[model samples]
Target chain A: MLLTALFVIVCVALGAGVGIYTSRDYTASNAVKPAVEGFLWPNPRIIQPFSVVDQHGNPFGLENLTGQWSFMFFGFTHCPDICPITLSLLSQVQKKLAEQDTADKVQIIFVSVDPKRDTPEQVADYVSYFSKNLIGLTGTEEQIAGLARQIGVVYIVNDETAPGDYSVDHSASVFLISPAGQWLGLFSAPHEVDDIINRFNTISEYIKKQE
Target chain B: MRYSSGFLFFILIAVQSVFAQNSIEITDVWINEAPPTVKILAGYFTINNHSDDPVDLVTAHSPSFQKIEFHLTETQDGVARMQKLETISIPAQSDFSFSPGEYHLMLFNPVKTTKAGEMISLQLTFSNGTNIDVEAEVKRSELPPHHHHH
Candidate 1:
């Protein structure tokens, strides 16, 4: 994965260099993926079909993110620490993008791995608590599993001997979808908000230039 | 008279066994590591099993909270993961400490009255149907909800 990630870095760097030359936007410097020493981007996985409803109580399919780069995350609203932290990191990515003043693009989506409990309203409340732009999604158990499987995320709910009294085991990686809604790549766990912001900033420019 | 010494030895063994069977001792208990508003907590302490057999801890009941379960906090790929444990194996004559970011007990949805420095009575049920009640002291620091694995 290290060599593959380095190759990705080279691709992103080359794209950034080209974008800088054409756009002449110095503020977009934030878009350049600043090399984070010791940080390795995990290989992107093929995403499976994910069925979920958006925060607005509307059914949102995977194709909904078409034409835009998305940072997709799987988590539950009830999660206290890690959930907030991940969302905050994604928000930082958005903030950095705005700081760079790059071409208008990017959306962050949060998919609720715990569906039976997280209603649309609950999703909205949870995401809104972090950032208004953050999208919280929920769906039935089967739909959620399909999406999780596609993203290489596995979440298991162990028995606590009672309903609603269980814990879920899930993958920790954040999914990154391309403008065409294809699962492009993913950001692994232990990611810092600034690191994500910087990397996405770099990727955003590449995405815009490809168009 | 010859039977008297044998009787004494058996009595001594019985007395020793009383303290040796599923003896659970607890110290340094607290719940304030994160915050009560967060609705989750991890309690830690040492349990020294003095019995001669394995004790399978299955269930935990608490009067201070709505529900209590055995849980473990593990960080996979730096993502904090929390899960409820179905059974914990406590070997005889050894100690098991339930601490943060490791083996722990998850106490959820405490009532408004439950506060720091309060005593929480949690009963641990074993596979053999023996149960030991432990009194834990809620710490000054709020108990964190999720394990922050790095």
Candidate 2:
């Protein structure tokens, strides 16, 4: 009887050891995801439904963001310095991604905060100057406010005497939206092309591995 | 041979100084090519003071625009805001760089169509009553010749 009890104890110890070892191995192989750089969200924020119009006068919403990554900036075409500069930097980013043959995986979107002045035709023309691949979006005040509010972007129209001589102060950071239309992270202003491309490639590789 | 090369290097440095020894030198001057309907355009440049005395930029006038103001874009707590400045002081033997997202010139009410590759002349008035004329080319791009800071 004592020998049988000893055999049972040995069996229980071996079973527990095997179970713990397998669980650890499973976690190492599957549970861990590669970490991203500064300002990456471990859990992407769910983007709510929004309706707007693209520069081509086509309906654009969260659905448009489906199946591709997007780097979105909020500014107006009238913004001379930062807006064009940011768009130019994004074009460089897109160029690098294109060299890697991953350009189709992502897009650059410029959303106008000054819808009162930035018409569809004007936006289309402005964005096309940057790159044909760049998309421009504008909409009714409410539609724009809803999307900007959800994304935590703020724009204030500065009061000036001259009618089109004013400037709209908006958030300068570029947000990275995931393929599933979730807010993944953001790259702040004073942006560099290499830094943005590197961060994007790292994130893309990690996402591909997860799939 | 090493002594001769060193002398050549000294001569090169002297030549560079001869070109840069002016009291106020403008470099990296550029302006954004505004859209047709937009009245206000932004301009950026850097001013280096090689003279022994400080220079105060008291007034700025651009023939292309009706009025010009020294403006600064300040991002505080993730919000970008611009404020007008009456004057900007440049210390002696120092440099003041006005680039995107920093000090800039806000040109209001363009007198005519300002296209890219066009030149706009600006007359700067110093506190000491010295006037400097700077010509800035209207260009559009995010990446300047120099790398971005931070």
Candidate 3:
């Protein structure tokens, strides 16, 4: 009787130990999923080919975004407040990346929704004020809309009281595109510099693991 | 006794001056300097109403810009839209701030390139029959400090 009781206690202890170890292993493997806020992982949407002109009047398509990570923002030069503020924050992000020697690995793109007013030359001049490394893209209304629709960006040109007087209401989120030209995700408006950098690093690491 | 009397007189004079001047106070006036090609700029400040009644800001004009208008930038569902406000009312004994991404003074067609550190003069008219002059400095936006979580 004494031998049987000792045997039963030993078996139960072994079973509990194995159960705890298996459960911990299960959770450890599941941690591979991207945990960053606002990150679209597992199934980032592949971008279709769409054409727009860059600041230098070069045709920019999905192929142009294939070489490096891209941070894209949609706004016009006429906007005095939010556009500049967002662009400045992006410039700071670019600067911080440069400090980490990862600047060349990433590219910043600004797309103008107000194509009627933001010509390629105008965009060229406007982007230069923010960062020399920044790429400004603008094109016809249809061209702009084609790309915007694919990325789920919405913009509206308010009725103008005069020829040169109006405002373009547009989505203020900053989009992150992978080097493979996939729409990874977006950082919502009122963005902070540290938050963006941290998320970018997280997403980048996750993408590396998948490869 | 003489020192106490003098202090009372000083208090009385201060009270008289407070009543003689406008009941509205302005501070922290500054403008966000934009690129040279950009036609419009944003100006920010804080308004304090010390009076017992609400005050309405009716008109604002600046010699440095061709036109000045009160505009509010409202963000809804990730879309940012700008609306013009004809008058901004400040309740009594409250503080109102005009900051980035919110209510601001839309300065259009600058008379000249306003550089950072330069002062722009503005005149504001209130519904309470008070006219106050303000000078706002042009400044570049600075990145906020990083927040660390323990």
- Model 3's CAPRI class? medium
Location of the lowest summed lDDT over 10 successive residues in candidate 3 chain B: B141-150
Best by TM-score: 3
Specify the CAPRI tier of model 1. Answer: incorrect
lDDT of 3 by residue, B1-150 (tens): 557988999999999667736579899899998888899999888898988889999999998999999999998999999999999999988988887788889999999988899999999899977889999999996442233410
In model 3, where do residues sit more than 4 Å from their true spots? A1-31, A101-104, B1-17, B20-22, B143-150
Worst window of 10 by summed lDDT in candidate 2 chain A:
A30-39
Candidates in order, TM-scores: namely 0.55, 0.80, 0.85
Off by over 4 Å in 2: A1-35, B1-21, B35-37, B142-150
Error of 1 at A10 (Å): 35
The weakest ten consecutive residues by lDDT in model 2 chain B span B141-150
Between prediction 1 and prediction 2, the one with superior TM-score is 2
How many clashing residue pairs appear in each of the predictions shown? 12, 1, 0
DockQ of each two-chain model: 0.10, 0.37, 0.58
The digit string of per-residue lDDT tens for model 2 on A15-100 reads 99999999989756753555655446567777898999999899999999988999999999877667877898898888788888
For each model in turn, which proportion of the native inter-chain contacts is also found? 0.09, 0.49, 0.69
Candidate 2 lDDT score relative to the true structure:
0.83
Look at candidate 3 and give me any clashing residue pairs: none
Whole-model lDDT per candidate? 0.68, 0.83, 0.89
